[model samples]
Target: MRDFTWHVFTQTGDIEAYLLYKEMHNLGAPELGANAGAEDDEGNVADEE
Candidate 1:
């Protein structure tokens, strides 16, 4: 699923759709293997403790 979305993004260069796809994919598991206060896909940092 990740690979397919990435492939479509690379092939069409549609950043918006790619981002949306990523957001949707991540919705189910927001912190699969990420750390606390981790930066989001857009690189925005969360508040640190």
Candidate 2:
């Protein structure tokens, strides 16, 4: 049991750390892999200040 736990942790530790970092970095928006801001038909942001 102990060895199995250690093996799983060793294999997934880096992936877990990376996922945590990504969650932390992309705090405001979900990582949906697409542009998330408002846009206009002319390819400009309509809400630009």
Candidate 3:
């Protein structure tokens, strides 16, 4: 989907931006595709389909 590394410099050093990012990630945790397994990746779910 969208790249978050770019947000690191998007002037999101505030509560609103933090929450937005947090919520975005929270909703995205379930759609992480196939990179959900293995020790190399964390925060990743699975391609349950």
Candidate 4:
């Protein structure tokens, strides 16, 4: 889906498609994996003192 969005953005120069690609890219980034267990169901990070 990200690749398709990116291809559409590149071929048509569509800002919307580019934004969608960026959003999908960010959502699937590896950085989130490191914090996956840190966040609760509501997405609030659980801090351990």
| Segments of candidate 3 deviating more than 4 angstroms | 1-12, 29-49
Q: Per-residue lDDT tens digits of candidate 3, residues 1-49?
A: 2234226426555665666666777777433344434643443444432
Per-model TM-score versus the true fold: 0.39, 0.29, 0.35, 0.55
lDDT for each candidate structure: 0.62, 0.48, 0.49, 0.70
lDDT of 2 at 42: 38
- Which tens-of-lDDT digit does each residue in 16-40 have in candidate 1? 7699668867775342332433355
The 10-residue segment of model 1 with minimum total lDDT is: 29-38
lDDT of candidate model 1 versus the reference: 0.62
Taking the tens digit of each residue's C-alpha lDDT, what string does model 4 give over 1-49?
6666777999999999989888988888332333345345445433432
Q: What residue runs in model 2 are displaced by over 4 Å at the alpha carbon?
A: 1-13, 28-49
lDDT by residue (tens digit), candidate 2, 1-49? 2233334557787665555555655664334323433343335545453
Q: Taking the candidates one at a time, how many backbone clashes does each contain? A: 0, 0, 0, 0
Task: Count clashing residue pairs in model 3.
Answer: 0
- Runs in model 4 lying further than 4 Å from the true structure: 29-49
- Candidate 3 lDDT (Cα, whole model)? 0.49
- Using lDDT, rank the candidates from best to worst: 4, 1, 3, 2
Q: Give the clash total for candidate 4.
A: 0
Ranking by TM-score: 4, 1, 3, 2
